[model samples]
Target chain A: MTAYKGYLIDLDGTVYRGKEIIPEAVEFVSSLKEQNLPYLFVTNNSSETPESVAQKLQNMGIPCETKHVFTSSMATASYLTEQREKQSAYVIGEDGIQKALEQAGITYEEDQPGFVVMGIDRSITYEKLAKAALAVRNGARFIATNKDVSLPSERGLLPGNGSFVSVISLSTGVEPTVIGKPESIIVEQALERINLSKEEVLMVGDNYDTDILAGINGGIDTLMVHTGVTTAEQLKEKQEQPTHVVSSLKEWKI
Target chain B: MTAYKGYLIDLDGTVYRGKEIIPEAVEFVSSLKEQNLPYLFVTNNSSETPESVAQKLQNMGIPCETKHVFTSSMATASYLTEQREKQSAYVIGEDGIQKALEQAGITYEEDQPGFVVMGIDRSITYEKLAKAALAVRNGARFIATNKDVSLPSERGLLPGNGSFVSVISLSTGVEPTVIGKPESIIVEQALERINLSKEEVLMVGDNYDTDILAGINGGIDTLMVHTGVTTAEQLKEKQEQPTHVVSSLKEWKI
Candidate 1:
């Protein structure tokens, strides 16, 4: 396929897995550097903020700065801050979520919250869920980091933060407005951060629904790769396909 | 307020805009028609089959199609079609996508599509869109129909199906999987054709989103009172709510 403009690369399955970046990942990024083509690490994983992701990437020998990275957590925080305007938010997640909220100038409240935010909190307990649900029931705006159903692991897969979001959603019947990958907040942020337009970017990833669809939803061309989650067999057998298909982002020319 | 297991009432700006439902709405739903109430509506908005939604209603709504009454396009179709055959499908939506395809004895394909199905064609486009997007791209499953975007007039909304679908999403996505309300193939169809479920249904109509949200997304809470899109003044102040809130579903609730 002809190279379009810049790139919007996925992080989890596309570049790295947990602490270890995938083989050829650095070179793939270096190629973008050589081309001076702007690329952003777009991830639906709301557990980590951009700064943390940048630090992680830097630790792994990938020369990425916080500016070149984006997370759904940032989008959720921005959207909530813009709309709710400094509301007192009760958060159940990680340092990433806390930092995002604080940076956005939102106050953190545990009870009678004006906002109830949920991220990928492994330490989630029924009590925490009750508190969060109670806050939402009492009129706090429910915000979720991301809705990824499963987190990729070397052990195959683990219940993602979405499972917890669902738990809270069940406790309180209000479905949180998901503002992640497929929802366009992250992509919108990426475009703004990189000074790029929809037509000037292409999204490359393995997941058909999340990564590829995010690009499509954000009004960009999408290339689906068969590196993770979706096997070649599934792609071949499935009816709906992406705008383009590749074996890996390593094979990407742009 | 004591929580009861009756009536899985919708909370989207209906009873509550963000913080709380209208006081009347809260009271009305709280004081339900019955107490042994376990009323569940299959609501996922997108990507879920009603069977899954019905199963996941927690303690909200009763999932039985017999005594209880709730409807979704998926549930409506499921009740209509019992044959376990895969018909061709050309869908413009998420995966719960295949539900209607399954019901109509249709299989979903992208390449050699048979039918051109469209429901709320969220992924709409222009020119070369309707002809190819749904039927060819997703594998034309069936020529479906859906025209509820402009429900019963007086909803004071913008032009709905006049373009949103036929021009924007539908015209580009494909013809449709189904269209129109009260059609034997639509929400009303399931109610009339199937001897199960409650008939004490109200064809609620709010502008576009509210009407469709309550109707096809899950269950027929079809309250389309002209509150939202009529004047900025209406939506500006969220006081005048709906029980059933469209101006011209044209029935006096009293």
Candidate 2:
């Protein structure tokens, strides 16, 4: 009775952007809804959570559910839990970070920490940096959320978590193994969560740097949608290519 | 009197790696100590705390103090605080995240976050994703710590923070504005902390991704020590080149 067993879709230009919804995106989702197809919102952005993303789509009349959304944050968290024994941690981020840690039942340090995890701390400070550096120097474990130097925006591209991760890595001389988009960790997480083999799922997105790379790295079929950031001309120039390409979600059979 | 008014140094290949220090690195520091030198350990790795890195180096027989460290985490976090009018947030990371927020005097939350920061949350969860997604959709600000997609390891290359940041970005339909290494924010933070002009400090590191980039972007002098991940051939092929390239930190003048 499942119209489609697994569907991993894109965000950004695919669903919404700057405060505008692209045409036909809603209709495309409506078709999936009419078919009772289960779809997942797979994205490359680690700055926000699925609930907020889904809510945005719905606000723009896309009719999305938070349950149907999965992010790199979820993927990376899943990957780390699988790779190591879960331990208490000191987080440097927001709800997305906390949710990930709590779901793993990893206790966090508000007072004293045994492990220091770095991400994009919008609220940064010298004391925080000193503490994190000290914790690592003193033998607390360290992990970074990701390593993106910049994220593109309507105004312009700007720095991201990689900059912060580098600071700690530079300061502590200890590199954090990151877990997020374009890495096998999130894909593996997605596969495990969907309860499907890699081949059964399709990765669709606009950006080649993260989404398509994620699919290729994760061992899934990738469908490049021209709806997001990358242009078709750009794809043709790439040394690598996706498994498939589409104009939008409307072009997919699922 | 300070033998050196300011110091900018490199990590990885310059300092200690896997229980061994590069030859003469210790002696070089000893010489600095023999004549009171004020120095700073600057690195491109964004995932760790400087205290931890300083300890790692000290363990390798190179003595360093926490005061002599600057990280991308602090830089980006500082930028975030400066841009925000209010200081409430939803975190998505580890010790670095909490520390940065507290030091910034930013109020943090699980819900109703004015700003949601995504970092390297190795322990991500569905609930966290949902919370962030919901908040961003509801108009909470989105920010990230860095943008490094891969990390260097004692073993090999691995997926890093950049990819994860992208994933959350995909989900939220909001791209993060970042502040870290290889960008002006962290560089400015470092300048402010040192209370010196860019001309007075020399950025040193092994990685071209961060250290060199930071100096170049910040308009500071950069020294690339041939000890870490990038090779001479790699440096030659860089889109941007460092001001000085040395065989080792020992051969370089302070």
lDDT of each: 0.57, 0.69
Which parts of model 2 are misplaced by more than 4 Å? Answer: A1-4, A110-115, A138-141, A153-155, B1-254
lDDT tens per residue, model 2, A1-254: 12345767776777766688876677777877888766788754555677787887788898688877777666656655655544677777766766866787678774456567766655655346555656666667777666665555453444466655655665556877666667767777777777788867877778888788888888888888888778988999988798788887677776
- For TM-score, the strongest prediction is 2
The residue-by-residue lDDT of candidate 1 on A101-216, one tens digit each, is: 88988888887777888887656543566567667767888888777755554533445666556655654557887778776777887787778788777887877778876777
Model 1: per-residue Cα lDDT over B82-160, one tens digit each: 4332445445544454555575565556555554444433333322233444333334434434444322222122122
> Which lDDT value does model 2 have at B6?
59
For model 2, give the TM-score of chain B.
0.86
- Please state the error at residue A186 of candidate 2 in Å: 0.7
| lDDT tens digits, residue span B1-254, model 2 | 11235556666666765467887678767776777766667554545676786777777778787776766566656766787445688877766656766677778876677788776665654456556666766678887776765555443344455655554565555887766566666777877887878777777777788778878888888878888777999988887788888888778765
> lDDT at A21 for candidate 1?
77
Error of 2 at B6 (Å): 20
Which runs of model 1 end up more than 4 angstroms from their true locations? A1-3, A84-86, A154-156, A237-240, B1-254
